[model samples]
Target: MSVDIHFNASALGSIQEVSLVLFKSWSEKKTLPMKLTKQGWKVSLSLPAGEYKYAFIVNGGIRLNDPEANAYAPDDDEKIWSVLLINAKGQRLHSNQSYRVHLHDYSLATRFDGPGLPGVHKQINLAIDESIVSRFEFTQVEGLHTVTLAWYTPDARLLQWSDHYLVENETSAPIELMFRCQPKTLMQSPLLGIWSLKMFIDGAFVLEDDFKVVDEEVYSRRDFLGCGAD
Candidate 1:
């Protein structure tokens, strides 16, 4: 059966392309090219019913696991790979199903295009439902819960961070939170890389997701002029 696989790494800028390294038949390794899309990367392939593991290679290097991968297991060397099961259509298998948290809606915006640069404007909008308030340990007080936004480099290093946001429990209704997070200094400009927004409730990690600052799209004027070598 042919199954469609998708991987979005919009947060990782400067990436020209991504390829899928599929581990099939218990030991066979197959590499397939994935197409780039405005949203991210995707590929479709038909394979015999069985289990498989795969990893994404950025450009020609940098192996990474699919952030939205259904399942994952570590190898003897401690390398992690995404897992897949081709049993039925529309059926999914996840290892972290119980701990999965959902946001009502979320969106990210940035001013710089193509790849991230220093001091680029960035923002995030998050909506939460009253039903999930207990997940953040609503203490009936607005000042108890805290929200943290951290930016990391491509190699996964802390680059920039914002102060904690205190949650306000004024009503038991749904609420939306907006954060304007862009660095103001050259040191902060080093924030040009893939990072994750982490939500904390009383020092506990409640929500987290990764994002990229650059992609394969050519945005420079020189590239438009056919004068720049990409």
Candidate 2:
């Protein structure tokens, strides 16, 4: 079977060579033969459907993470991504298909907003879901601060759905308004899976937008302003 792995490195940097290895189990022979390309990489091998462990050997000796994997590991403060190989016939080979993986630096910076701030220094506790699927941080400039949260899909598709909370003295505070700019794919799900915002001021609801559900990916800016004060 031929498995094609495609990736863009113009965002990360020109890569010299890439290496990959597949392990049949925790204590099995290691399969380390894959090819690289200008766009990504591909491999041709004949193996039965089963759970496998893999890793990326970047350049020559640098071990890196897989950008396409579905799961990730937090080891020594490092992230790793992996994928599950299944029979083309759609039969379950392994009970656990969820693999931990990490995003390439290029993909992370280009596809998502960064420094997680609007201006100068600020104290923020950036939290992400266990899947590392989303991130939250706070930015401050001259004592004026705002919280910014971001989410993304495995394919580097930005998830438009998100929420930010304003707190004062360790308690939720009222927000004046909230705004978000996201891609149209969020409208694909009947539930408007893209980014969303919820605002509250003085312990009361100020504004909320669930977003319009649609069939296509629509990139647009949504604003919620002039909410009431309680």
Most accurate candidate by TM-score: 1
Off by over 4 Å in 2: 29-33, 70-79, 88-230
What C-alpha lDDT does candidate 1 achieve relative to the native structure?
0.52
Give the count of colliding residue pairs in each prediction. 8, 19
Report the poorest 10 consecutive residues by lDDT, candidate 2: 101-110
Compose the digit string of candidate 1's lDDT tens values, residues 1-230: 77778776544446777899998644688999999776668898877777788877766754556545665565566455667877655444555552222344444554223332223223221221111111122233332223444455556654544323334445764444545444334243334455566553322345566665542233677667896656
- Which residue segments of model 1 deviate by more than 4 Å? 88-230
Among all windows of ten consecutive residues in candidate 1, which has the lowest summed lDDT?
A: 126-135
- What's the true lDDT of residue 91 in model 2? 47
List the pairs of residues colliding in candidate 1: 11-211, 11-212, 11-213, 12-212, 13-214, 142-167, 142-168, 142-169
Overall lDDT per candidate, in order of appearance: 0.52, 0.37
For residues 1-230, could you state the per-residue lDDT of candidate 2 as single tens digits? Answer: 44554433332234666667666654674646467754566665556676555655545543434545443333232323354566767443433443221211111111234443233111111121111122223222121112223333323333443333333233233222233333332433323233233332211223332222233443344423434534
- Candidate 1 lDDT score at position 161: 42
